[model samples]
Target: MSIDLSIDLPGLHLKNPIMPASGCFGFGREYSAFYHLDQLGAIMMKAATGTERFGNPTPRVAETASGMLNAIGLQNPGVDKIIAEEVPFLAKYDTCIIANIAGSTIEEYETVAAAFNQTSDVHALELNISCPNVKEGGIQFGTDPDMAAEVTARVKAASNHPVYVKLSPNVSDIVAMAKAVEKAGADGLTMINTLTGMQIHLPSRKPLLANRTGGLSGAAIKPVAIRMIYEVSQHVSIPIIGMGGICNAEDVLEFLLAGASAVAVGTANFQNPFVCPEIIEALPNVLAQYGFSSVQDAIGKGVSVYE
Candidate 1:
């Protein structure tokens, strides 16, 4: 049977549910050589700030058991550069474009969103409110319901495209944060950003990363991501773009069943630049095994039964 994998968010329509996490996928140029960039649902560009960022100091990344820690600190070429250079490059492809914007303050967030507001190339905005690696604006806005809502409202007001609030997994209550953003008029939600973690070096007798702590990702956090997506989906009405440790087609299906309208691949990109296409190619057979004819039919299947 032919399987239809199309998924629709507020103002966005994806041919499939697989896309790269913001920082992992670099403006669609590097990965375009591996496969047709338009084959995937969308391209979530690197997080852009109001101004260019040098990012964190050296040794900002460390490897752990089944995952990796990164303190890259939202390093980007800034919003203007993205609009002038990156967006046009990506617009050459057939895939939708989702800009992930970050800032050190509320006004910065507004500025970045407003800049994108004038662009027709961008299909949506994924607010990076949950970046733990950043010191100023990321996790701070995501961890607090009030601040999360405030940022959502501000960005929503400034954005002409749909705004998706990416929530932090470090919070005490993921559902509460999801609800807050929804109430603040978020068009969609991206659940469970990387968890905060630290690694120690045996010889140096110090932290492995220069920043001391970093956001942990990969297979290590898949279970947490699933749980948070399940919980948040139950509490909120907006569409969810679930991401965390998604490496294969099975993992993507699991996220969809857990109530995610879409899923994103992160560290997997570093290991296999072809992973996204691999997963997309395998999706049809997997859906057949589960007796699913279309991707939309499986979304929130588990949640509906549990509730």
Candidate 2:
């Protein structure tokens, strides 16, 4: 039996429910060499800010047990450069382009969102309000319900593309955050953006990362991601693009069963640059093994059965 792997989200029509998570996939230049970019679903470009950022200092990344911590600081070549240079390059491919927009303030978020209006190649905007590696703007707006809603509303007004808020797992109530963004006119959600964590160097007796704390990713965070998606999906009506610790096709199916309409491959990209395509290739077989005829059939399957 041929299982259908296509998925339709707010602004994305994916051939398969596997796309590289923002920050991990960069601009798809390097990965394009590995395989044809069109073979996969969408590409979530690295986080873009209103201005070009140099990011954090060295030793910004440290490996932990079954995971890694990063404090990259949303480094990028400003929104203008991305639209002029990077966007067009990726646009050459048949895959959907989702711009991951970040900011240090509400106005900066608005500025970046407005900048994307110049490009028609970008299918959606993944609002980076949940970046834990940064010290300001992102996490502040992400954790507070009112602030999350306000930024979502502002970005919605500023951009023509569909807006999907990336939610912080660091919040006390992930469900509350989801509801706030949905009410603010968010088109969809990208859940469980890295849990805030830190690592220590035994030799120096200090923090491992230069920024002290970083957002953790890799296999370790999959359970937390699944739980958050499951909890939030039950409370909200908007679609979820689940992420965090997704390394294989089984993980993708798990996310779908837990309530995600689609899933993004993050740290796994670092391990295997071709992980996205690999997952996409394996998805149909995995779904059939679980008795699912299509990707949509698996979505919220676990939630409905348990509830």
lDDT (Cα, 0-100) at 282 in candidate 2: 85
Q: Write the per-residue lDDT of candidate 2 for residues 183-278, one digit (tens) a residue.
A: 999999998898899888889999998999999999999999999999998899999999999999999999999999998999999999888888
lDDT of 2: 0.93
- For candidate 1, lDDT tens digit of each residue in 1-307? 7899898887678999899999998898889988999898998999999999999998989999899999999889999999999999999988889999999999999999999987898999999999998888888999999999999999999889899999999989888899999999999999779999999999989999999999999999999999999988888889999999999999998999999999999999999999999999999889889878999999889876776
Off by over 4 Å in 1: 304-307
- How does each model score on lDDT? 0.92, 0.93
Residue 238 deviation, candidate 1, in Å?
A: 0.5
Clashes of each: 0, 0
Q: After superposition, how far is residue 274 of candidate 2 from its true place, in Å?
A: 1.4
How close to the true structure is residue 146 of candidate 1, measured as C-alpha lDDT? 97
Q: What is the lDDT of residue 49 in candidate 1?
A: 97
As a TM-score, model 1 comes out at 0.98
Q: Which stretches of candidate 2 lie over 4 Å from their true place?
A: none
